[model samples]
Target: MGFFDNLLLNLDASVTGLFGQWNIWTSLLATALVGFLTYQVATRQDPDTHPFLLARQAQGTAVRQPGESPVYRSQAAPHGMLLNAGLNVKDPGASKWSRGRDGDLRDVWRQAVAGVQEPGPTKGAKGRILTVLGAEKIVEHNLDDITRQINLIGQHIADQGGNRVAIYLPNSVELLATLFACAFYNLTAVILPFDQPDDAVISMLRRSATDTVVTAPGSFPFDAVVKNYPSLRQLIWVVDEGSKHMDWNEVPQGTGGSVNVSTWQDIVNDAPLDAGKTLPPLEGQKEPRDVTVFWQSKPGQQEEMVRFTAGNFVSAIAAQIFAIPTSQRMGPSDLFLPADSLANSHTLVLTLAALFSNASVAFNSVASQADDLATATGGIAPTILVATPAALLKLHTESKPALSSFIGSKLHWLQTRSLTQKGMMPAAGGLLSSYYDRTVRPALGTTTTTTTPNKKKLRLIVTAERVGADTPKLSSAVLSDLRALTGARIMYALTAAKVAGAVTQTNFYDYRVFDDKCSHFGPPLTSTEVLFRDTEQYKTSDNISQGEIIVRGPCVAGMEAALGVAGKMREDNTLAYV
Candidate 1:
C-alpha cells in the first residue's frame, strides 16, 4: 500500500478505538467525500464549479423526500435527558465561519476595535465598551495576555488531578481570566457570588468540596472557612502590591490562619506566561460529560455542579434555535444590551444563532429598567434585543413612544424566555396583535436570506416559566392575572410543573398538580440527581395524574455518585429514562 493508504489505515484504527459506534458513520462521511470528489472531477466540464455548488447538488441527491428537507446532521437537539444524537462538530477548525480570507474571532475583535469610530479626540479610549461589567479596562486587556494566563493557571490545576477550584470575587478581569484558566485545564469552577455572608461562603466551600479557594484579597476574611473545612487544602488571595496582605507583610507570629495571600503580580511571575508551555491536555479529551461549574439553588442549599461539554459549547444548541439571519437589516453590527442576570444559555443562543457574528454585549449592574435599556439600545441602534417578560411588560406600559420607535425602526428581532405558560395566555393576544400591527409589520425591512425561507425569518423563542396546574385555561387571560394567580407561564403549567409533583395542592384550568413534593420547586436547570434509582421505581403519571419530572441533560449541575451506600447498583442504572 502507498503512504496515503497506510495513513488512512492507522487513522481508521485510532478513531474506531476512540469512539466505536461513531467511527462507522465517520468512515461513511469520508467515503462520501471521496465519491463526491471523484464525481466532480469527471463531470465538471466548466472551471466555475465550486465545492459549494457540488455539495448542494450532493445534498439534493441525498435527500429525495418530497416536501421533506435535508437536515444538516449537526443540528442541535432539544435540551432533554438523553444524550444528543449525530456527529459532534468540534474536533478542528470548529468555527461556523470557515476562517476564510476575512478573519477568526481574534481578527474580528481587532477589526471591530479599529472599525468603530472613536467618539471624541480621546483616540481609542473614546468608543463604547463591548462588555461594561468585566475587566479593569476591557479595551486595554490584551487577548494574548489573557490567553497566556489561562494556560498558566490550567497547568497548575492539571498537575493536581484537576481538583475543583472555588473562585470568589467581584465581577472583574481576574475572574474572567480565572474562568478561562479553568476551562483550559478542564477543572470544575465554582463561581461563588461575591459579598455573601462568611457563613454562606463557608457552606458553599464545604458543599462544593473545593480543594483550593482563590479569592480577591481581603474580600471576605474567609479564614474561618479555611480553618473549618478539611477539604480545603490551599487558599490564594489576589492582593495589591502595598497591601497588608502582601507577601512581604508578615503575619503576627502567633496568628494561626492557614490561608495564604498572594498578589496577582506574583501569580503572573511564578506561572508560565506562554500558552505553548502552560496549557496541557486536561485529564482527557474533555467532553461535555465533564462537570465544569457548580450552581446553587436557594441561598442556604449546597451548590450543585454543572458540566458543559466541549460538544455543548461547540453545538451551541440554544443559540442556534434563537438566532436571526444577518442581512444589512440585522447582523453583527447590531448591539445587544442584556440584563446581566437575565442572560445565560438564552443569550448564548442569541449569539450562536447569528453565525458567530460579533455584537456588543453591554452589562449593567443595576436593575436595567425599560427606559435605561431602550436608551442604551437606541444609542447603540441594536437590531436585536433580549428582555424578560416582566421587563417587556414594563417597557410596553411605561414608554410607549420609545418602544414604538424601537419596534418601528431598529429592532428586527426580540427573544424572550422564562415566561410561565400561564403568562403567555394573557400576553398572547394583545401583545402579539399590538407588536405585529404597530411595530413588526410596519418596519418591513428587506429580507436577509442565509438558508431556507422560513429559517431566515426573525423569530422569538420564549421558554414558559415552570408553573403548577391550577389556573384558568382561557386564552384571553391577562398576563398580570396569570402571573399573580398562577405564578408562572401558561405552557409550563400545562406541561412540566402542572403535571409533575407540586408543593401545594392546586389545580388550574388545564394542569393537574401534586402538592407537597420537595423536588417540585428546585430549578430544573440547576438541580442534580443524588442517586440513580430504577426507572421503574419512579412514580408514574398514573399515581395522581402527575408524573415525575426527572432532571437530566447537560445543563443540570451537582450530579455525582453517592458514596458509602449499601447496595452496589446494576448495569441498568447507567442510562436515564426521563
Candidate 2:
C-alpha cells in the first residue's frame, strides 16, 4: 500500500496496543484521537466520490428545503444528523398522505388531519386521538375545522394592530387550537410557564411588550399580573363556569379593576368556519419569514427583545430532514409515546412529518403509574416512543415485574433531551437493552432482522452538557466512551449568558456560561454575539477562555438588567460589568 496508508495502519495498531490495557483515562485519550481522526477523514471524503470508504460513516447533515433561507441551512446542518438517521431506516413504498395544499403552519395541520384518517383498533367505546383529560373518544380535527381556525385567528390579529395575547392553560386540545389561532391571526402568543413564580409571570408580561393578556378563568389567579404590569391595556378571560352565554367584555371588574373580557364561544360562533374553502392567502408584504415573536431576555443592563422569525421553527426543519421514504407503508393504526416536553413537541412535529411519510400517532399517555401505562399503551402496542431519563427511571423503578413487557415490546427508539449527569447514561442503556429484548424485537414480529431501512438506529443526542472540550476532567477517553455508548450523534450546545445574531461555530460545542443565563430564544438564526473587553478582548478563536461570555446572535435582545443581576455592559455593548 501507499506510505500514508501504511503509516496510518501502523499508528492505529501501535496506539491500540499501547492503550489496550492502560487506565481508562489513557485508553480514552488514545481512543478519542483515533475516533476524531476517523471522523475527520470520513467527513472530508465525499459520499458520491468515495462512496465505499465512507458509506456507513455518519457526518452531521444540515437540512435545507427548496426556497428556504440560507440562515435555515446553516442552523439545520447540526440537527440534520438526527433527522437523517430517522429517515434513512424508514421503509419505502408507503401510501402517500397529503394535505394537498401549501403554507408551513397549515401544512402541519393538514398532516395531522391525514394521520387521523387511517382506521385502527378501537381501545374504548369509540375511536379517537388519545387525550390526557377525560376525553375518551378523541381524534384529530378535520381539514375544514383546521382551515377555519387558522383564518379566524388571523382575522383577529389583522383587526388589531399587533396584539399580544397569552395562552394560559394546560396541555389540551384547546391549548393546541389557541396556538394555531395565534399563528393564523399573526398575533404574538406569549407562553408563560404556569409553574413559575408570580413575579416571574409579571416580569415576562412586561418584558414581552404585552398589550393584551388572555387566560382561562380559574386556571390561575391574575392578581400579580394586573398589579405589576401596567402595559396590559386589555384582559380577555375565557370563563367556562357552567354558563350558557359566554361573557365578552372590554371592562372586566376584578381586584385589579376594569378590563375587557372575551369568551371562547363568542369567537367560535362569530368565525365563519365554512366560508373560504381553502386556507386564506398569507397577507402582508412579508412572507412567513417576517412573522416574528419577540422573547424577553437579558443582554447586559438592557432588556433586549429578540423575535423568532417565521418558517424557522426548529420542528419544521426537523420534519423536512427526517422524512422517511417508506413511511407511507404504515396506515393510521400506529401509536406514539412522547414522555418529555421536547419529545412531545417532536410528536407534534412528527404529525407533520408523517404527511410525507405515512404513519399515524397514538398518544401513549402512560400514566405515572406503570400499570396505567401498560393498560393504556398495551392494547394499541405503539411502534414509536419518545422519552427522557426521568420518565424512563420512573418506569424502571416502578415496573420491575412488567418491565420486561415494557422494554421488550413496541419501543423502536429512545429519544432523550434533558440529561443532568453522565452516570445516568448507563442506566438508560440497560433500560434500552432490556426494552429491545422484551418489546421492540418481538412486537415488530422479527428476530433475525437486526436492522431496518425504515427505523433510525439507536443514537443519543446530549444537549447542554456540563463537561465539554474545555472542562479539565473532560478528556479524549471520556469522549470515546460517550461515543461508544451513544454513537457519534452526541450533540453539545455552548450557550452564552446573553447573545444575539447567529454566527457559525467551528467546534463541537460553543463556550457556555453559568446557570440560568442562556435561554433558548427560538432557532439559532435569532442568536447574537457578545464579548467582554477586559476579560475577553481577543477575537481569535485560539484565545477563547472562561471570561463572562459575550453573546452576539439575533436572539440576544439585550441584558435583562445591565446594572442589576448580570452586571453592566461596556460602552461597546460587551458585558464587562460581570
Winning model by TM-score: 2
Put down candidate 1 lDDT per residue, 227-259, tens digits, no spaces.
Answer: 577666555566644573446324445442543
Residue 386 in model 1: lDDT:
44
Worst 10 residues of 2 by lDDT: 465-474
**CA lDDT, candidate 1, residue 407:** 48
Count of clashes in candidate 1: 23
TM-score of each: 0.46, 0.48
Against the true structure, candidate 1 reaches a TM-score of: 0.46
